[model samples]
Target: MNCLIIDDEPLAIDIIAAHCAHHSDIKVIDTCCMAMEAFQALHQYEIDLIFLDINMPVVSGLNFLKSLKEPPAVILTTAYPDYALEGYELNVVDYLLKPISLERFNMAIDKVRQRLALPKPAVADTASVRNLSAAQSGPVKNFIFIKSNGKLVKLDFSDIHYIEGMKDYLKIYTHDKVHVIHQTMKNMEEQLPESLFRRVHKSYIIALNAIKQIDGNCIETEKGGVPLSSTYRDALLKTIEK
Candidate 1:
């Protein structure tokens, strides 16, 4: 993936570029010392991700990001943690507090790759649309492709034990491995088949067959106990009875 690093500090730019060099998949297309130079770079190249500093002279990074109607995946790098919430609010892929460690930098890039890999929603034009019959379509799919460690990994529905939500990411628990994915809980709920999975809490989704017991406000699974919210308790019970 092509990357653009934007920072006022020469050292900061060099540090990020050095880190980018470690990843074979990441190509450092250009580094800009200011927002205007960064703007020119954006027009000149096809950048997949941007390493941006939150605090810069004249125009702040967040303000620069606001100007773009559609931006490539952004990872905010800053000395201050105050703008972290604001950065995530702007839909940045990840927030890295400087001085950024190589491990942390790798984590951020993984998120960027995943965000770039996510399928874009199709825009249909009725004038040029083609119709397909039901008989021509294939059978139902029982697996889903999730971005894990910068690659799309196919996972079967039956292997999912449960899912736990972080602020802007999800921990998908399978029988043996836990996959971290950049996605919202609402989007995951919509994508998962309702018959196999159920949201037991705002932060938890348990596979119906994976539930060993529903003890009080907790749902037990082989992995661990998940909190059951009152809002979804009735619905879970109703589904189980059916």
Candidate 2:
């Protein structure tokens, strides 16, 4: 994927470019520090994606995106979490916060790949899929690959105690460590198997088996207590009952 980095800060541009280097499929076509320069670059190159900062001098990133007649897939890179909703309203591929981690950057690129219908890097084991299907009566495969620290980390569903939502990112707490990935709660909810995980609050999703106890509005896990919102309380109870 040919990507353009548009941000006023040179450091921010350098960071994003460095991350993009890790993915062989992604190429940094050019970098633009101002909106006008980016506008020209977009016209000149067949750009596939953009990492844009919202707080640019003169023409803001949001406004520049609006000005495009046919904007390419965009991942908003900004320090302000408040612009997340507005960025979504503009149909950005993903919203990434400042000090973007390599893991987070990879997750955003995955979204762009999906949006463009590009083939994903081989992560799933096809042999496992066939083997599980042939068995016909065993537990479903329950592991996922998440980008962490510039590499793909395989995590078993059983290891995850809970997931904490942080605006455009998610903090996945497992028995050993915490992994931060760029993903929305809604996306994570859909991706996770409903039978194994349940949304107990607006900002939390707990592994059903990991919940040790429920008290008032809290659900206790091995690591810590997670909030159980009234909105999801009844549904959670019903899920547990079954």
Candidate 3:
């Protein structure tokens, strides 16, 4: 994989480059200290992977990933374990905490290689699109079965207002109830329809029919007004305007 390291620490970058050199398949294309530098490199080069750091001066790793229209597979390298769960929620390939060992690094790279080996799925995700459209096309009995805290909860599609993303869990907001599930927002996003649900933030997704109001940097869904993320502000506006 042709990779780039977006980290402020020079030593960290050097170490990562050294470790990656041991593997013939992984190549360090360039090293950047900030998002802009990486952004420029992205335009200049055909990079396949990004070794991003969570804690940076201005734009963090997560925020950068959120900004991309087509993000490459990322492997987060950070000192903070607390953000590991959150990183996974973004569907990053791997999370390697600081003081990375060769074995651990190898394991993470192997996982990425395995994913790269998988066959590419077809573009026809239309069957799912039609089902979701049918739900709102008319008064259809639309619902989804979700695994909550300890049991399976069947929630009507219209009952949900939006979802809140916690580290490794999600808070689902129904008409009069909020249920927390030990699953990532990305997992829930895959099951929910894009027509009814839109990911308005890195940490939020809202049902189009349940929004009461939309304020700058926030949303007033049926559950309550939740803060909107700057990372997804533009995307949400585009989706809601239509």
Candidate 4:
């Protein structure tokens, strides 16, 4: 999908462009620093999606969108939370706040993809429903963003070895280094994809593919060993068997 970025701030434009560079499906065709420039770009290229900043000089993003006869899918970017309601009223695909995380940006892109692929209003059939279900489960995201040390850290599922839970904080063991973040084991477990991670113990969650061996109640990863509780061992075994 071709994307156009419209933001007055150069840093904001750079951030969005950097995030767009990560997605193989999105191609950023043009970037505009002003609403007028964006209007010109719209006429020049076939834009499928837009990353629009809400507060800008002259015409606001919402006003510019309203002026367009048929605006493309827009994901509003803003520092203020006050514009959220107004942005939604314009039927934007998603709303992203300033200093957007890669994970959140990817989610917004996914929403744009889903919206663009939607069929017109019609009676749903069994086959169509099945196809929709398949589309919704198209592919699992390969990475996640973890907030640690006052910044968002992106980690690929493959790079994670295991996670050890401490009181009020969790330690994530990865290929290169360990990240200590203020998070609960349950919350971390919920965030990770079940296909890649498993809750082996109340205090541990290990990447399924990272498990080198399982000896009795201990699961060994490349980094270190994690205790596998009897409560979750059977479920882990079931998954491995499948």
lDDT tens per residue, model 2, 1-242 = 88899998654664676566556577778899899999899989999999999998999999999999899999999978999999999999999987677678889999999999998765436454334233431455577666677566778898999999999889999999999977667656644667799999999999999999999999998899999999999999998887
Candidate 4 lDDT over 36-102, as tens digits, reads: 9999999999999999998989999889989998999999998788988888989999999866766
lDDT top scorer? 2
List the candidate 3 regions with Cα displacement exceeding 4 Å: 118-242
lDDT, residue 101, model 1:
64
- TM-score of each candidate structure, all chains considered together: 0.49, 0.51, 0.48, 0.50
lDDT of residue 215 for candidate 3 = 79
lDDT of 1 by residue, 154-242 (tens): 78999999999996689999998999987667657645667799999999988999999989999999999999999999999999988
The C-alpha stretches of model 4 lying farther than 4 A from their native spots are 118-242
Regions more than 4 Å wrong, model 1: 118-242
Error of 1 at 23 (Å): 0.4
Compute the lDDT of residue 44 as modeled in candidate 4. 96
Question: What lDDT is obtained when candidate 4 is compared to the true structure?
Answer: 0.81
Of the candidates shown, which would achieve the greatest TM-score relative to the real structure? 2
Q: How much does candidate 1 score in TM-score?
A: 0.49
Q: Candidates 3 and 4: which is better by TM-score? A: 4
At residue 201, candidate 4 shows an lDDT of 95
Candidate 3 lDDT, tens digit per residue, 53-117?
98988898889988988888899999789888888889899999865665687788888878778
